[model samples]
Target: MEDQTTQPSPGSSSAAYPRWVLLEMNYKKNDEDEDSSCSTPADVKTLAAARTTSGYPIQVSLRLAEPPAASCVCLQLQVPDDVDVRYPTVVAAHGDSVLIQVTVTNDLGGFWNATTDHFVYNAGAAAAEPPREPSLSMLPPYYITDDYSGPQAHQLHTRATGLIRRGEDELVVAELSLKPARKDSLELKTAELLLFRSGEWILKRPRMSYGDREFGELPLWLHTDTVVPIGDRVLCWVNLVMGLLFCDVFEESPILQYVQLPMDPCYGKPSNRNVCVTDGGGALKFVNIFPRCCCGFVGATGCQRSHGVYVVNTWTLRMSDMEWVKDGMVDATELWALDAYKGLPRIPLSHPVVSIDEPYVICFLMIEDNKACYRDQTVWMLMVDTRSKTIQSVSLDQGERRWYPDTLIPSNVSYYLNSYPTSRSDGTSKSNGQSQIDIERSLVQVRDDDASNSMLQSSCKLSAEPAVQASEILAALQEIPSYGLDRDDMLKAAYRILSHGNGHRFRSLLSLPRNLRKDWLLMEIKASED
Candidate 1:
């Protein structure tokens, strides 16, 4: 073989010399001829294996044969999983190597086994080197929980009161909590009272001093009572209570007037009186006042009429000498012969039930029929143009059913009957033989655009563009049974046909008004259709 070892200068322009030699040998061989000679191939192989025995505990040392032109050279070592390597000492050829230890985990429960194929040094040569494998260990455990016991556990209650005069104005009172629901950590910190009116909630006042502390009492119930409008004064009563000590708030103001009513009775105690702080209008006139009595008796005696007291406003007008009609109905009294306004007019019936909406007063007549106790008893609402003193009776078909006017949508009212007692004839009565009325009520708005009113007016008019007969319409309507037909429904259908250019035909039958006669026909038609 040619001489493979040579030494060359650092910067010499010559071919590179071999720095190290690579040897390859097999670990096992099979054959008797391989071991025949004293220095057989098998013996040579055995010696080679002994020299490269990686299983034996061996110490590896590295040294620099010559200083490199550059000061630094990166050193990397990789070992198999089955092998254990430790670095006792390390020195920087130029600087230092960062020492780091890491441990990895394997869930398979098997020994980590790894092998190495080759490695590269300086990107110039490659050799068989150990592969890098991570150290393994066991994973740890973790846990979590939630607990609360601070100032977030309190409850609240509310109370409200109000008073109103028939035509003048109204007074409202409301109270709220100063703190949040939780009382332990958070206490009642001041509170603000807000007035919800005319589509907006405006901050009225802020109450700071409530029985002491800057934030007020811990178990305190803040209250707000005020007279609203501040003008057009009226007579009214209010009593409300909200159960809460601390309350959460978004905003507050002190511009609103706050009156602290005595807490002896808490609610509206006529005895625990408040003054009208507002101005204008007439002097405070005491109208018809009815006391609200609780269901319990007073002073440990039998049930009395004046236990828990409240007052409701009846009417407020500058009139004297009001006559009280002893009618069984709640609202049926008349005022007559007033000096300023005389013969003004008395309510048609003995008692008149009236609901006041600003300038308009809705009057209804209560009819009591002892003969038809369970069947025909009804309440009739008589539409009255109070200003003109004109009256029109509105008969309810199912008057025996309980009915009430809707407050929100005034035009729409609801009617319902108790179904528990059951109808005796229908076996709807319970075992006790008490029959409950079955009734339901829905909302309805008056159709002002309805053609019935116009046609009826035209029929009565003498110089109408096209004269329609009132008698003819009446005759046609009278033929139909009026038992189940709703008055508005019949009138509505009649108006529908009349509007479709039937005025001449309606007038030809001058005996009855087209509106009336058509209503009658429509009633019959509806009954037959049902």
Candidate 2:
């Protein structure tokens, strides 16, 4: 990458620069430097061509001849101001091993010097895939439980099921249901979540709600609008039950953690279950949107109950840094906020998601007025953008297919790695074991109605083959013996969650009935164990 020049802070000495060796982007020496013709990439040359005497950035890379050291190795990257240095710009991998990854995009074509945390650390490298001859684990039980409590043998429901595949990071998210710790309590709202990658299982933040009011049995569920995967981080547009999405930004550093975004109108609180979309830019551009809350502009006016041009708005998140100002000597941070699209009259928008095309977002507008403004019950495509502050209404072509957050577009082929099992285990399989997406089965709750099928009709088709031998998982007081409920009747409350889920390998199963227990949501996940 090209070098960027900046004025040093007043009275700050050059010693303020980091002591670790600074890595440059345009080093021409490497394994193939002896023969440059074979090793060059067209993208690299296109970047180099943009350089000028005045100055511009060029890409840089440092590939270890062997694996990285156990200790962390910090990297200093040079990018342009407009390059969009958010996460992995590119990633190089051999088999399952990640050799090098570029996480920034330069817009100005010159190197803008940017600082990042520890760049290379071999933390999970040892957890690489096992030999072809696999051996199961003995400790955390890489296998499913032997419990035989199910409507059809030993199956379980899971909603904490999703996958993130950008460059080198393939994080598979799954939830683990637990038996409660005390009486009067159902299950832990903060249930455990395991992220599977390479050949190992990594535990991530559990299913939690913001837990502001009280640490109730409900989880701090940031309802997933959609997962926006950048180079090394995956940003989730989650909600707070109001259908407004907020961003959960995960940063990969020496310490893997979620960095809080700018203060939202919600007073820096997290929520769940809202519609969301992404800009598909290099940095994570998460826009959690919902039907406009027309309750007098940020007031609690039960706006959904009122009828009008039902508009939409979004709260967003992006990469930011906490600065120690030379003037104040204290940390100050620039933040993000809700930027509403202008140029359009107030209109009602249904569950909206991002369009595959850039500078456009797709959502359906409803004729929400009791007056004769627009056709009632008819859906129109609403295209909106914040930077442009513009909105447009368009009619779909006759016989044209519609899209939704869960809409299934036809693909040449799909190998549903995380679908139902052929045998009697749960819906998941470990990497070292059978190739099933290592999900387990337990009895959970299911709603008894076909009213929700209309949403599925618009979503995408099946991603994996449907199981010929499908089963349902239910929760029984019988499973928990010591929650002070020795009697089988009072132990685990009797509950049933049928696998009537729909969309994207039943990914939308998360919308199961709300009557289901807060601690144990009704999820129809695939069972991997037999």
Candidate 3:
């Protein structure tokens, strides 16, 4: 419909090198297969079916335009709304260029929505990001062999060293082919990742890993010995390789400031894995949630016998010293652990979600059937405030929500505010006590009156209020009469008002009854999720 090229904004340096232009509205695989029918202005069309997930082929194609001279051109494959897509891959022709590859990368596995789809191909442009020095370890492979085409390929060896760039992160991978190096005794490799700072190799992680060459296990794991550069400092995740899985992170400074994830009563064994190390905003977030299940002992007397879990732990990497740039969790970071309280049967937590607008984690609760040891399965919204360490459970009866059989999760307001401006958790640190009072006063429900508007103008900040006073705001929101509407309808009204900056809340959630379909009377934000 309209052009949506990955162009810099008007205020940006208009001198963007190797500009992209739209020449045609579609991509045609052959003379007969001509279909120009994608919505975005990039005008992407079906190239080839690389792989299929949920019966949807991962198709790969290019925009009908010249490649950027400064970088490799990567584009997002805009799947049509009518497609039953799942985890898919890109396809290439029999003799096509060997560059096409499939990527299914989401911290919570792969699921892209209509608004926040991440299908942009990274054409390996160092200038695209703020920092200049690129992840310089991606290289092509060189074959060291004779008659490598036939089944005698085992006689040949291959070696390579190069950089691989995912969306915002990069990795320097190195590989080598050896001459009968005895596939039994492991080949040990040791090296160090050095960051070339103002001309010095600031030492990072020392590379050390044993390659199980017999089974083709890599000698060095990718993240075990790695250095990722955040803002001014580098976040280093180093496996000490000292018989234990304990890793040390040297943050900001290599000599002084550092934190070690130690072993304890539960995670003392190296076997307890570090599931992920996320750049939470910039807080250097790490997860160690390992959940396992086992069959019960013969004739054992336990409540958790029928369940598939015992305990779960989720730790947030909080910054103790705040002198440096302290960034933490962003929106939608998932924390998955089947941690049903011990001896109380399994909780089987589902739809786990880290908050976007708040510093809390919320999930829907599940209960064991016909169990008497613990019967508070009526708890609906299990919320854990990471900052306050407060675990508050909102029972189904608390909201009188038990009568509504159609209700799934206690509909929350955060989902609708994903696109709306939210106060950052860090914004609270910037405000004084008076500013806090100003925030609370401005949050009273916007009444439809000049006197109320004048009162709000005197108390409210000229700009947006920080998220420091979210609890007060939620209280204020609750005081407003729901009038038979749920949180979903309230959020829809809030979205409409914020988007258009007009209309009353209740009326905003409603439209003139559709002539054909009265079901459209109320707006549905997440139809599928509901």
Backbone clash numbers for all candidates listed: 48, 73, 10
Per-residue lDDT of model 3, residues 91-197, tens digit only: 11000111222222223236642211112122223233341211111112222245645222111011111112223333222212222224563553333333322
lDDT (C-alpha, whole model) for all candidates: 0.24, 0.25, 0.26
Q: lDDT tens digits, residues 197-228, model 1?
A: 22233544354433333433333334432222
Stretches of candidate 2 above 4 Å error? 1-143, 149-159, 166-183, 186-188, 199-230, 235-237, 242-307, 321-347, 355-377, 389-530
Off by over 4 Å in 1: 1-191, 194-205, 208-237, 240-252, 255-530
Model 2 is weakest, by summed lDDT over 10 consecutive residues, at: 327-336
Q: How far is candidate 1 from the true structure (C-alpha RMSD, Å)?
A: 39.9
Error of 2 at 389 (Å): 4.2
TM-scores, one per candidate:
0.20, 0.32, 0.30
